[model samples]
Target: MNLLVICKASTQIGFGHLIRSRTFVENAIEGNMNLDITLCIIGDSSLKLLLKNPAITFLFYEDENQILLTKSYDAIIFDTINFNKSVFDKIRFNAKKIISLSPVFNLMPFVDICFNRTQYWAEDIEKLTLKKYGGFEYALIQRNCNRIHSIIYKYGLEKRYFNIAISMGGGDAANKTLEVIKQIKNIIEPFTFWIMLGEGYSHSFDEIVNEIRKVKKHEIILAKTNHSMWNVLSNTSLLITTSGITSYEAAYAGLPTITFYDYDNQWFLLKELVDTKLTINGGKFSDNSINNLRNILTDLYHDRSVLYDMHKRSKKQFDNEAANRIINIIKEEVFKT
Candidate 1:
């Protein structure tokens, strides 16, 4: 079986799509079936990451039209919204199966399967002629590394006490991370802060790091890209992150997270998750919200039962077996088609 995954990774878009696509490819190959996987990435950094995997072929394209002229495959999975009807029409006749992962607001007529993890399909499924696999479970990672170690091991350093992780996706579009860090600095005692600065933060990354370092007891570790984010998730006790797929990943790791929903797209989903007790709605980075956040964290640190209950709910929501179920669905729907 030949599978080609098309994904985009940029400072503005973040690395979630590419990361999830890689997870899918990795699991597909682990079946011991004769599978040939290829990745068509949009960004140079994403291409470089794909090149690290010797088992898969890598192709970089400036536009979707370029891919239309290329050789076809058994299955072509699109992880980006850049490809539209014209591009899909070009390849629809060539590929045996066409799957779109996490499409934004639109559906392609040429697409045979749609795997949406954002709960978008529950509203409208009759308009498209495709197999709809929708829900948060689609964001599951194939835990090739030891799940226990991936969650617990950290770079042993004497300064590893009470490390608070602040990750606002790979893009950090609204510059929410910097604001969150600033708020944390106001009320808490100094602790090591692992700041996962994505490629998008390159412009002001140094300045932010330096500013955060001014505090006597804070250490800022900037990570541009990490294949094993689960490792970082496991080592941290408290997380302050944006409400996205990462929120669910943190939950699976049993990490109590405070998610902020500032974007219009994420408002409803964030509200739903918070209402379910899966996560706390740490209001956006604002003057008024800072004090509330400080109070919540202070209280949470002392309440062991509440923390444990939250962790239990999160783990239950993000089951480890989600990957296996996805693979099974692909075999039954995609492969059969």
Candidate 2:
């Protein structure tokens, strides 16, 4: 089988789409399904770093015209907002199956199957799809990265002291990570801090490293281009991150998390986490909300039972086996089509 995946990644949009698509490819191969894969990404750096398979082909395009040059695949999986009906219609001539992973607004009606894991699908769009699968049914893209699992077990994370991970996605578009570090400077003492900044962070790398140096009594480690997030989350006791798929990853690893909302697009995932009490909004870092954050942090530090209970609840909600279930869905939907 040949699969073509269209996606994008950058500092502003982050790397969730690329990461999730990679997970899909990984599981497809592991299922012993002989396959050829091609990735169409917007950025060269993201394409080069994210796609590791030698058999994989890469293409870079900013518009729909590029779709005309591609050969037909058994299926085409799109995970970007940029792919509209025009682009799909151009390629639909040869492609046997058209699948979308978390579409932007459900504008494309011809899609064969729509896979939305977070229940973030729009009601109007859901009604238009030929077939729609919703909920946390297929979000488990982690099983694709075998190296991450090995790293998790090798890191001795299960036996470590309290471990806290701070991740703001592939790009820290709002530059809120440093502010988050400052807010927790005093409170996170005695905790091992693993900070993963997006490769596209706007601030100079030096500036971030300097700030880490200023923090006292905290072991701050910077992570770059490493796929060890699963291992890091597996051993982590708590997490403070932007509300995105990483929150789901933390949940899958059974880590208690505090989430910060960075953009309006992030609200869907944030709403779900907030409703479940799996995450708390660490108020924005602007002057208007800074005081609110200070108070929330103070209160959070004093309430140990609330923190513990949140962690316990998180473990109950997210399952590690989610990847396997996602794989099963692909087989039943896209491949079977």
Candidate 3:
């Protein structure tokens, strides 16, 4: 079967959508499904990372203005946040079946399947005609096929400063990484800081290195897009991440995380996750917020039981089989349709 994946990427749209789409395809291939796949990415020049894989063809469009496909695909999956009118119009008439990821309001009544995980759609979705699959059971967590590692839940509290991880998503669009790193300088914590810098991060790597110079043991990890985080996440005792798929992925890895958002779109959902006691909410990047964060960290340092409880809850929330379930949907529903 010939399949086309239409998703958003680049430093502009952020990497969550594209990462999940990539994970979906990786899972499909790992399952040994017989298929020909082409990923049509709508992003800027930073999107060349999608082309490194020979198994899938990559078509990078600078904008969402116009997209063309050579052949009508068996099924096309749309994982973008914005509903492109032109792209939708073309896919509606061209593709045999159309499916979407999350935030389904825009594509409702026009898609065959609405696979939603965050439930970001504000409209009355129950009234929509399409089949909706909602819950974290469908959240896509990208892992490198070669370095894929399972989440082994940690049973006890941390002893402080053993292994720390910092992953601020694919790009620090809001420059939150710099602020977070600067604040880390004030904290009295001691540990080996493993900072993962996204490929799209506009800031210089030297900036982070200089800030954490006081630490005796630390490493700056620069990961290309779609790179596996297993190596770093495997030994991580504590993690600081942007509220997105990584936080969800960290959950499945049995790693506790402190989640914050520098973007407005991630605020509501992240706040909800915090209120539900999923991950530690560090709030926004601010003096007051950082002070609040400092207090949280201090409390956690004194009593590691908090991290243990958070770890247990996160693993329960993230169902790692989301990608596999997506493929089954295509085989059973899309094929029959």
Which residue pairs of candidate 3 clash? none
Whole-model Cα lDDT of every candidate shown, in order: 0.65, 0.64, 0.68
For residue 268, model 3's alpha carbon misses the true position, in angstroms, by 5.5
Rank list by TM-score: 3, 1, 2
Which of the predicted structures, 1 or 2, would earn the higher lDDT when compared with the native? 1
How many collisions between residues are there in candidate 3?
0
In candidate 3, what are the lDDT values of residues 1-337, reduced to their tens digit?
Answer: 7778888876755787887788788777777567777888888866776446677778888777768766788788898767777668866766777888755336666888878666454345667777777666876766642211324334223444556677777776766666766666555655455677677777776776676674443344434334646665666667788877777677666677788766565565565457657678877756777667666666777777677676666655775678778778777876683
To one decimal, what is the Cα RMSD in angstroms of model 1 from the true structure?
Answer: 4.0
Q: Give TM per candidate.
A: 0.81, 0.79, 0.83
Alpha carbon lDDT at 36, candidate 1: 74
Candidate 1: regions farther than 4 A off: 45-47, 103-105, 108-110, 118-129, 142-161, 188-191, 213-225, 268-272, 283-291, 321-324, 334-337
- What candidate 3 gets wrong by more than 4 Å, as runs, is 104-109, 118-129, 145-160, 213-228, 262-268, 271-276, 284-287, 317-319
**Ordered list by lDDT, greatest first:** 3, 1, 2
Per-residue lDDT of 95-196 in model 1, one digit per residue for the tens?
777777764535455677777654554334446767777666776554532232322422321132566678888777767777766766665544567787
- Each prediction's RMSD over C-alphas, in Å, is 4.0, 4.4, 3.7
Q: Give the CA lDDT, 0 to 100, for residue 20 in model 1.
A: 71
